[model samples]
Target chain A: MHELSVAQGIVSAALSHIKGTGKVREVHVAIGELTLINAEQLAFAFEIASHGTPLEGAILETRVIEARLRCIRCGREGKSFTCEECGSAMEVLAGEELLLEKLKLVEGDGDAQGI
Target chain B: MHKVSEIEVQEDLLAANRELAQQNRKLLDESGVTAIEVSGAIGSGKTTLIELAAKELKDYRIAAIAGDVVASLDAGRFEKLGIPTVPLNTGKECHLDAHLVSHAIEKLPLNKLDIIFIENVGNLICPADFELGAHARVVVVSVTEGDDTIAKHPAVFRKAQLAVINKVDIASYVNANPGRMEEDARKINPFLEVIQVSAKTGHNLQRWFNFIVKAVEDRKQHGI
Candidate 1:
């Protein structure tokens, strides 16, 4: 699915963000529900996509974010786009993000200090 | 130093895509072109729908960008219809990302065209995560695929502005219900417009053509 391509993006982003030489240990990502990404599927994809990269054994740690919906007319809050109170469509305020949050790296032999 | 440590990055991975998509939208707006991205599974009549549009929408100058994993089969079909066509192949990627669409748009005479129909790499799941800088996104689900196609792939429906249940002529033989698909699509997104048609027989496709016309008109008026 799209998870494999996204996992490759995570590995590449991690590689570019790190300073100097280091073996990546873990890559943390925040996945939102509205993005429709399955965390377990992403983990499996990360394992495969990172196989030949610097993040060969790096763990893909994902955090899920819930979607926040709000209705405009009545200012009511609900999950689905259709509002229960007003019956009008709700707007999405949060969730829809796929961000690379953090990275854990093991310093290489040539590395002098931890980043 | 073999020490292990964590560093904060907080980088947005999808930012590049969103930015490029925005750029593409701006370019299309400047050129007065309305792009319609059609996504569906293989054999879902995506090409046929576009072919019909090319033949019928004579008032508008139409071009096409066909995305496939390999081969230019779809592009060839568009070319045969006397339409300018660009074939894009994403070697291993499952979806047509904004980066790829922008690359294809560069090769086209954007200012000379009134509409561009982008046929996404045939599939439901992967395309949902990717937006190809289209004013309207339509998902085509055929009767041969099954009634549960829309229910199983809600993400695509949620992202699309409209949904098309195609191959209605053969629905009885296949035991597929287009009404169920239409219902499922509307449940996911209230604003989404669902239409059923048979591209093969040219049945009820005028409504879909009307949708394209209205979408272009709306985009022109809304100034997005």
Candidate 2:
């Protein structure tokens, strides 16, 4: 599955940002509806990719964003490509994003929390 | 007691691939090679369309990079057509990434080739996510795959610059409506150029060839 490669990307990104100082607690990723990525498959792939890495045992959390299209003629925004009011062709404004949003990490120090 | 912290880092998952794609695009431009990525599902007549195009455009120096899971059957087919073809065995990867294309380009005689066709691995979904530094992205969907094939895979249609509904000669035999397929493709991407051609009978193939020639001319003139 292509999700395996995507999962590996997330782990690589997370590790680069973490700087190997903390244990990864969770990875927050945003997947758009248009991306058609299966969350379960991505999570499973992340587990395999993060194996023996700093992200080992870390949780994978995905937030799905619904696809939104904006009509070019009427400037109407909706989910579908056709506008309800003007019935004109819509332009893709949002969605189709596969982003690594943030990382939740537990610091090695007992009390010092790094942000 | 462990201290938890949130690190704010916003990065696109495909950032790495996109960066490599940009580099590949620059390389193609510098080499003056108009690269087209031909993507479609397996048995969608991609190989036939390419073979016909290569044969018709015999005056131009053309090369091809055929991508497959394990076998180089498509590469061999192109080679037999007198086109210098490179076989890229992806080996379990569902799609061809920009990194693979970059390496393939180095193996080719870039200065001697005018047009390079990168026949992507036969899968509609994964290839849509990967950009192989092609000046034009062509998605081929045959009538035998059913009329709803375009509607079923809107993502690739939306990303593709041109949509070729191939095997139109057998549309009736296959019970597929080419008109509906064209309509669906346009609905998904209003700006997409939809062409219905039978790679077998060579129907409307001149138009396909003309499109590529015009695209190359435009790129050279406009430096796009």
Candidate 3:
């Protein structure tokens, strides 16, 4: 499944992120409309794929972006599926991406002795 | 007071699948086997075309990977023809991705094969999005399905290296136009190699076979 591959990427990214930092608690991802990733399946796949990695217990946070298209015939700028003036098929200019937008890591130990 | 901290990381979600697809491509190239993947809606005669290839490729070692969402009937059909087949059951997934192929290779002896025909699940929209380690993706359409299917699903035709118009023997019985279909396919992808065939009567099957053999030889000569 594509979800398995996506999960593998997330696991590898999380492991690399933690390696760069000291620890990782959560990872946030922004998936655009065209990626067609099922969030629930991706989460399940991530949990299973991360079982042997350093990100075993890490959490996955996701944000979905709506698909946006631009009118080719007219210079109209709006969020409608088709242009109101010409009603032609719009080109997908944006919002069809699967990006690892953010990662939240622990910088230092909270149980430090210093005030 | 509690402190809140966040670390930023940017990554690509399709990185793993793309990497694996590249590896599969390298494997296919090195093995000298032209991996051809065919896609179309159900009952489009993809298996029949594959059967034609298997029958004609007498000198070469041919293997196949038939993918279906539920059953392995297509793969079973290939196996009946004495060709080694690896059945891929995708469960609920619509298309066969690269990782599934990478795993299917374990069951197939790539070193002994010259051609690997991957008959993708019978669907147009979902299969277009995946790269299943194929050297060429061929799309099969039938006269019974109407000529406007290419226009309705332009992405599938655009992604395919070849477009096959099958079931021409029944064209007169169904009022189908081959000329318009070819035009629509070319409009979607001008470079698409279009072939008309009928698996029932074996018309133009030799041309399809010639196309496959020539494609394999061409790829071999170019070292692709």
Ranking of models by lDDT: 2, 1, 3
lDDT of 3 by residue, A1-115 (tens): 3577678778777666554434456678877765557788888888888786766666788888776767777866555444667765456665556778776655566332222
RMSD of each: 2.7, 2.7, 6.5
On the 0 to 100 scale, the lDDT of residue B34 in model 1 is: 95
Task: List the pairs of residues colliding in candidate 2.
Answer: none
Docking quality (DockQ) for each candidate: 0.55, 0.53, 0.25
DockQ comparison, 1 vs 2, better candidate: 1
Candidate 2 retains true contacts at a fraction of 0.66
Off by over 4 Å in 1: A108-115, B1-4
TM per candidate, chain B: 0.97, 0.96, 0.93
Assess candidate 1 and give its lDDT.
0.87
Candidate 2 regions exceeding 4 Å error are A72-74, A82-89, A108-115
Model 3 chain A worst lDDT window (10 residues): A106-115
Off by over 4 Å in 3: A1-97, A103-115, B1-7, B172-175
Candidate 2 similarity to native, TM-score: 0.92
Please provide, for model 3 over B162-186, each residue's C-alpha lDDT reduced to its tens digit, 9 standing for 90 to 100: 9999998998888989888888887
What's the true lDDT of residue A65 in model 2? 76
Model 2, A20: alpha-carbon shift in Å? 4.3
Scored by CA lDDT, what does every candidate get?
0.87, 0.88, 0.79
On TM-score, the candidate that comes out on top is: 2
lDDT of 2 at B12: 80
